[model samples]
Target: MTGTETLERPETADKVEHFDVIIVGAGISGIGSAYHLQEQCPDKSFLVLEKFDSFGGTWHMHKYPGVRSDSDLFTFGYRFKPWMSAPIATADEILKYMGEVIDDNDLAPHIRYSHKIEHAAWSSKDKKWTVDVVRLDTGEKRRFTTNFLWMCQGYYNQEQGYTPEWDGMDKYKGQIVHPQTWPEDLDYKGKKVVLIGSGATAATVVPAMADDTEHLTMVQRSPTYFFPGQNANELADLLRAVEVDPMIIHDIVRRVALFQQQEINRRSVEEPEIVKQELLEGVRAFVGPDFDMDKHLTPKYRPWQQRLAFVPDGDLFKCITDGKVSIETDTIECFTETGLKLSSGKEIEADIIITATGFNLSVLGNIPFEVDGKPVNWPETVTYRGMMFTGVPNLLWVFGYFRASWTLRVDLLGDYVCRLLKHMDEMGVKQVTPTIPDSLSDMKVGNWIQEEDFNPNYLVRSMHVMPKAGNHPDWQHTQDYWREKDEIPALDLDTEALVYS
Candidate 1:
């Protein structure tokens, strides 16, 4: 057996282990945390515990056909690693990229895969966290303690998939599938498929399935705003000509892409109607006037209020125009043995049903956590700077925003955490937590975004947190690259908002 396999197949559990910091969830955030931590605190004993056998978190778990990043690779990719391949990367490619990152950084030894964290509790007297974990394969339970606990655990559990309750769903004779936990061996060729919901997943899957499936119908409760993916050939060509180190190329491309995205966002904010018109016109041109654009195309909310679905080269609209795909905007009244029954008294038949209904916003996964033996209610605890939660000592959470690439925000948070850890070490502080000022009220804190059709759990929780702009210019929430570089480095680590002891 390989040395790695030997270690993984341990005969007995190592019940008592210690670390300077314990990071949960080995996804992008967690891996990023490890990368930063290793650089900042080389001497510190740190461990990354992932529930799954492999890395790549979300990218690894989601294996549906046509699964790829909605955001362009340049900005969506890690700051340290440049996206040298396609501007829009596929799931498998992204996963491979993640694996390379882990290998390059020598992060394998730090990670213990299949080690699912069950619970974590803080000991006020010990000034440390006692974390309980389980080995899924062996059903072995063990405990470990750490000076700091970092939750890199992403906001969703792929296993606890979301399935909306539609009447008569149980009666359906055909195979029902949720894209989150898609079946491997299911065949779609020559099958009439009905895809439920109108989100990113649905938008992506419909076009992909259209080529093989006899006919694909998208059932929508409400319409989602659509935007064409701008994988700029000009930018791609420029990067190709001036090919430098992959790392440098990645950084340059990331900056350029960030600028482009910011420009789009700026135009949308300044000229909402014009931006809306352009988007609608683009969709109309692709889908053709034969399709009812007014009924099925328009969204209830303004652009960027919720994420606009990205269709690469109008792939989704192309499929629709070619008669391979169709969209139904009526409310799903119930499910039937043959297909879905709409409130309009129309029944559409399908041999297979795919529920791209949406995801459960696991702001924090169901893993139980306590501070000083008191149960911590996540909703009740205010988020600090939208990254860390107030009242939770020595803990940090990284979450992305609706307006920018998730990795951009996550990179910044990772840097900030590294800086914070360094600052804490210098001051010999054992614990740190945000102190939410009494003056800060819900009235002062406005929602960053709102959409009737989009899921609100994560956004709502994040809105109440102090904005980077209001707190300090460095912590201020501009997604611009130059501004972030200038401000983030200059952030006052000893800000009054943070309590150190």
Candidate 2:
């Protein structure tokens, strides 16, 4: 910070860096956009503006002890790049993979690190968007113009994590930390550690720190669905052993994984008993028959009501069986001098506390957007294919499927944007917007999330900030991958749904 404040900056404060298309992030989505831009639109000039000093958005931000993907790499990894390592990859591996992609694709020249896009204004007369960019160093501001704006910035607040105010939190003398902003130097070796919350983060941290800490405890208000999966995928290993090309292996393995995910998701809702018994039996095998699974594993709601947390090779259960970890399924009444006290009068002693709570969802990078001098009201607008917003011309936001792998939809989006630009060029059109009929105008505005029954805590907290959806499919955002897969690619550009200018 001192060096930043004192050094002379290179990016001129008032200079504008223009491009044909301007992407707002350098995470997985943004990088994929760049790759597709190179592959599909070779002549188009573009720039990727990253807010952080480096790439790997979520992976780079959360540097806690156990930071790995809940979903395996078969689908989470890009279809273009076959993930050949362990099916479940660590944060470091993902970061390295991203860097390799950028290097191999010669995308480093197009990236502007430490550049944040703040606001954008569109002019109908100019038929172009004027954007404001801010440099994190020296607080310099600049302006740029683009014919199209691709919002690849991810859907959560990067700077902060959601931590509810617990009673008597100030009295705890030990160090308290949040996983979003973990300190590199904070040591937990041989120290008692208690992680609060039963979400994916807490599940990940318990097993990761079990061997390092003197004792590890997971505190949860209620139980969440846990799915124990094999760490190594034999299918991938066998495919590689038989000398199948990695890309072909990726194609087959990705589909197999997706189909498996879809089948499990279906049964979780339709045949809950089958999934419940299968999952609990895996736990019971490790924890023994005498263990009280009703208190620690059973949830009142059905499976997939919230996200199903995954632990590879049953690592979390291994920790519990090894006597290195314990569970507290109760509410925290208050924080004592050293640890938290439950409402049931149960006390947990800890030297360090990690709040693996959740995230504050963000829509469109929290940027102020204006078209022809009028502010964009998202809730008043309807979404098109969960990507483009009605009345917003040539602006597409890459929001992937919630239940499926995020990259699956984003890969489609990158190609779709390229195709859209080409189609506009062919038709001599400069702008396009989704148009809804007057009959749908007065339709009841409901939550964008149709499956409210599958409510996660983070989505419940931040759904208000997102756009609304009506009853129609064209007006609503569907979370089904198969439906979107068949429908989006075959969409007609000349249809009445899109108005060209």
Candidate 3:
């Protein structure tokens, strides 16, 4: 191990293993990080440790009904890899694609599955990190050391999805389920299904369940915006029809999708009313003018303040329009023996309650971290180029954009990390940190991410525990991908505030 032999990270008698870099979480980010590390620093030996039993983080974990990509596959797929499938692809398809990436790149064996990380401590004297881990199968404790650490654990609590308590939850006789913890043999067929959230999960599940179940009711406290996207990409279709090369088609489609996303965000900011009106018009046309657009469609916040859920061919709206599905936009007073009792004095009968209430936000996978025997305060650490944190040496975390496809930011961070590693090698640096000097310490810093940027309840609830941002370049989180593209790549590593040892 790189650390001193006297200091043992694992309490057990296991000897410590060491590597040049240690990547946490074998999900999308971890896979991408491996790819970049291989390409950028081929000589470096690295290891990937996953807490879960398999790869494909979100796709492997989430099996809720109709779970699919909210963003276009082109944008969601890795930048180097062309998403050749439908614009909006199902979870299985996405998982298969991830499998292809891992297999084609020969990254599978590098991943140690069912290996849960328990603790991390950095040694300043040795410039190495000692990580404690445990294998789920055997209760034996293990230890590993690395010069660099990369956290790919996504920004939400992995253990469970967020579900609020109802007044009479225990009184409910029907089966209660959360999207995150979906059972293998869940039988909603021929049953009345009532979903209790209006986020992406509920929007996705309603139409799928409606097709099979006797009825599906989406009960929401308020409405969220939904936009229509074609199931297939026109360019991909046209290119295939003309017998064009798939590689070229992939590049062109990826570029076009990014441009379109930028344009939509721009228009939302420049003309909020117009975007809102047109979005509502889409719902109106699909559900007919008679549908209660005011109650079931309109949102209190402006467009793009929260991500607009994607529904291909307006399937959800069609379900609502055809009266195959219904919506209740009110608070649930309590759960009854048969269904939910609303505060509006209305009772909705259902056999099953699916709480698609979204995830509880988490930062760095809630892993306990210490540096030189000191507990690192994450909130006080300003974001370094929206990836690394202040006072943390040789560590990087990947958090994607809320307004766009997560892979967009992931791809950027992957490439940036490779570049950073190269720079560090050239400088012969063992450790690097964005340390605040006396002059810049007094400068005001902002929250890591602004609440207004995304008005989602999950984010609002857990943001306080996360890191903060600043108005300055090194500390701010520019959610805009296009702007970040210019700033991140060009960031100078050699700065007075940045310490290299």
How many Å off is the CA of 9 in candidate 1? 25
User: Mind sharing the TM-score for model 1?
Assistant: 0.90
Candidate 1's clash total is 5
How far off is residue 363 in model 1, in Å? 2.5
lDDT tens per residue, model 2, 297-370:
88877777788888888888889989999999998899999899999998999999988888889889887787
212 in model 2: Cα distance from truth in Å? Answer: 1.7
- Clashing residue pairs in candidate 1 are 82-250, 468-475, 468-476, 469-476, 469-477
| Per-model TM against the reference | 0.90, 0.95, 0.96
Predicted structure 3: lDDT: 0.85
Residue 499 C-alpha lDDT in model 1: 80
Best by TM-score: 3
Looking at model 3, report the run of 10 residues with the lowest lDDT sum: 1-10
> 1-501 in candidate 1: lDDT tens per residue?
111221121233566798999988888778878888887778889999999898888888887889988877777777877677767778988888788889998999999989987777777778898888888878998788998888887876568567778899889999998898888898999999999988888888998899999999999877888887554546656757876566766766677777777777777778878888888988988987777887898876667666778888889988988999999998989999999999999999999999887776565666667787576666555556556666788888776655667777667877787788888889988888777555543324333233342334334544443222233322223334445656666778787778888
Runs in model 1 deviating more than 4 A are: 1-14, 230-232, 438-488
